[model samples]
Target: MDTQQNTALTRALAEVPGPLPARGVIHIVIPHTDRFTVVGNHLAQHPGLSTTAVGFAVRIQSLPQGTEIGVKALAARFPEGEKLIAAALRELEAIGYLQRARTRLPDGRIVTRTVFCNQPSALLRLPKAAPHQPATPQAPAPAPTPRPVPALPFPLQPIPELEPTLQPVQVLTTAPQSVPAPAPKPEPLPPLATTPECAPAPPPQQPAAPRFVPLVPPPTAPKLPPRPLPQPCELTPELHRAATALLADLRRHTPEFTLTEVDIQQLAPAVAAWLEREARPDTIRHVLTNDPPQPLRHPAKLLRHRLTVLLPPPLPGAHDLAVPVRRVTVTPFQTCDGCERAFRSSMPGRCRDCRTDHAQAAA
Candidate 1:
């Protein structure tokens, strides 16, 4: 009886409809309270927009005004390359979700200004046809027809109630009033005999204050700090030439290191100081050319700093004064006692192969 009851319960459960089983790509959505972007289905599910374009539109619409939405900035934040991001931005622009206009600023700089539209359909909608008006008897003066106002692309907020404007209305009266006679004008008396002493002299006019003008200097490139000068030292013609060549050739390693002729001349003396301290040319080159700042605005200043700061001290002792000499030792060739092969050795001995063979034989 218990088994039958259990079977009946199982049958009833199967017959009852419950929650459907989870399927592919189930989403658990959480309601947002703050710091969220509102995206519309028109953009998210646009048939003409590609996936990248749709995503860009959604992100741009959610962003606050003045936020950077340039292709390079987006590429840096996302995994897509600049080319792909630019293409997506173009697609969004074509679909009316994005607009780019070149605006000239007060400072005389021409920049691209971007405007994002969440509801483009409003602007794209056609103007409604004018309402038909019945022909009435023509009057001498006809009122001008009002033009239709175009729809704004952005959503409109509810307008607050305003106080009604008061208009002046003229009132008419139908009453007869008695008229009064106008008084005659008084006769002008003869000009009083004015003596020069009785009449006051015209007041003297004071001179206007000098106009104050503010002197503003014209805009110019910022002055870079002067390149540091190296300590005074006896510069030789050879060292001077080598230093100049090193400074001039820096452009080969990195174009940013390119310096003007005047810059090279000014910086040459510093490089000469490095040479005077027994610094190798290669070391000097590396110090000056290694990891220069990008978009180098002042190459001379940078080289100057490196030259003065990184200049190595003169070699200790009298070694720096003496000429550097490199000595090489040669090993004499010898015949292997066992294999009769010629091999280089410091002292007469068996070659490596003969030694291994002799050791194996002894073992």
Candidate 2:
């Protein structure tokens, strides 16, 4: 049938209010069969089945077989509309009330076939199996006899005899004997020899002539002066222009403040530092003017402070001018006279080992 005919049939079946149905009403017949009651009860009691889904199921059942039920048509009939109708259709498909399958046509095109089953048995019934050859019947096994559980043994008896009482035994008491200490032995006095007066006179002869030793001073190392700090680089013309523009913009934003040449020079280094860090002039201007917690009385000072705080550290110089290089004299290694080992020393004659040995020998 054509679209117009189908629409007319649907409208006739619906019996919608208009000029036609004022006195009499048209009705769509829904079968009162066991299958219908089972399906309806199943859908009504289903926890997952929504009201819209139940309505859709009822409408689907009321409609004649082979009637094209599009989502749009079902949505127009149902209060929940298209999304709900689509969901309802999916629910029905999931629970076996409705089923859809894709079939390839002769023209190499695919089409979907949807089947609606009102009766639960139609969808739930199992297929019949193939017939098997008859076999001889076997005798049933004999029933097993239930054995009674054994009774537990009588409660354990208490011991008849009591333990013997412990008795105290008498212990003898004796006085401890004191031991006597040994006496100390007396020390003997050393014998004195007589001195001869003739031998004492020879000892007074010349306490040898006093010898003079030269004093040696300790070696001192030369001290190096501290390094000087590197000077900041000069600002280029581009940097100067950027700084001037930034200041002019800031002045415009804060009309109460004035930027002088001295202020500009003082702040130029900060601006140059920011520029070196790859921050654009516009970005710096935005940061300075966009949000000020309080009124900026000294715009130049604030800008300088911000630039200084945010500025990246300076790059390393190719050649550091502050640190001066000094010539260092290296002593040649000489073999020690005592240990026969090579060692570097400031003194030319002997190594430290040999010198320590000679000093010990003299001592």
Candidate 3:
């Protein structure tokens, strides 16, 4: 049908209650809103399921008294137009119209239904309708006037009692009685005149007693004997000799060597020996990602790694792990130096843990 005739038929059909088959195109538009472009485009895309234009005029014709165009039923109108239906409904929602969709099962029976407000799933505001003066509904009368609201005339009848029971009525009564007045009391005579001479007031209150302060003694920590001073051992003499020799060799040329446990054992066995001498089986402490940054804790092998390793210039030339030497951080994890987290991360340059050493030194 031509757009004008089709629209008229839709308008005519909207005034009455009846079902219309879904043609190849159903254009449901909100009337007075002039949002037909979106619906028209949507309907053009879907050539499978039949559809008819629906607008304010169409809506008025489709809905009967005390009835609404249910979305569930609307969905059922186009059995094969599910995809286009949402687009159609979304157009209606964008124009501030609600939608109801209905479905039929494969066995040719009504099944699922969905009633949705004209809303975007993401919760966008629906466009509001412009000001519209609705047509005044008219009714045929003696002089052609709107039909009056019919009175709901309930016949005058006595109310029936629900069950055999007596309702109690409560009433209040008053009892009047007069109380006797008390007898008047007599006024007492004034005391005889006293002497006019005034004795000097007692001296002002004595000054407040001096406050007594309680003294508190300082807390005394238990005095434990100081740890014995480590004495220079025969091994220490040997260590001094070895250290002096190594220092002398390093002076000749830059030194680079791996100091493994065996190497350390061979050289500075004195410190290890001392540690072994003092080692207690239960004195073990679990180490996490804590690296000893102090030169004193630097093993000979790690120093050698640095000597062999040519780090990327701390300059911003290259990306990735390049960082200011000040920012580079290394922590000890496991028992190896090569192991790192799955994702490469720079170690913190300075550790806050050493702050306690500073505090102790200040004290």
**Over the stretch 240-268, how does candidate 3's per-residue lDDT look in tens digits?**
46533442343234323324445443434
Q: Write the per-residue lDDT of candidate 2 for residues 127-220, one digit (tens) a residue.
A: 4443332232222344234232222244322322211211111122243343233233322221111122232322333443322111222135
CA displacement after TM-score superposition, residue 266 of candidate 1 (Å): 71
lDDT of 2 at 130: 30
Q: Which ranges of candidate 2 are over 4 A from the true structure?
A: 1-38, 76-80, 119-127, 132-363
Candidate 2 vs candidate 3: the lDDT winner is: 2
Model 2 TM-score, all chains together: 0.26
| Higher-ranked by TM-score: 1 or 2 | 1
All candidates' TM-scores? 0.30, 0.26, 0.14
Among the numbered candidates, top lDDT falls to 1
lDDT (C-alpha, whole model) for all candidates: 0.72, 0.60, 0.38
Error of 2 at 308 (Å): 42
What tens digits encode model 1's per-residue C-alpha lDDT throughout 239-320? 8898889888888877888899999888888888888888888888888888877778988888888877777877787765
**Candidate 2, 273: how far from true, in Å?**
34
- In angstroms, give how far residue 105 of model 2 lies from its true place: 2.0
271 in model 3: Cα distance from truth in Å?
55
Against the true structure, candidate 1 reaches a TM-score of 0.30
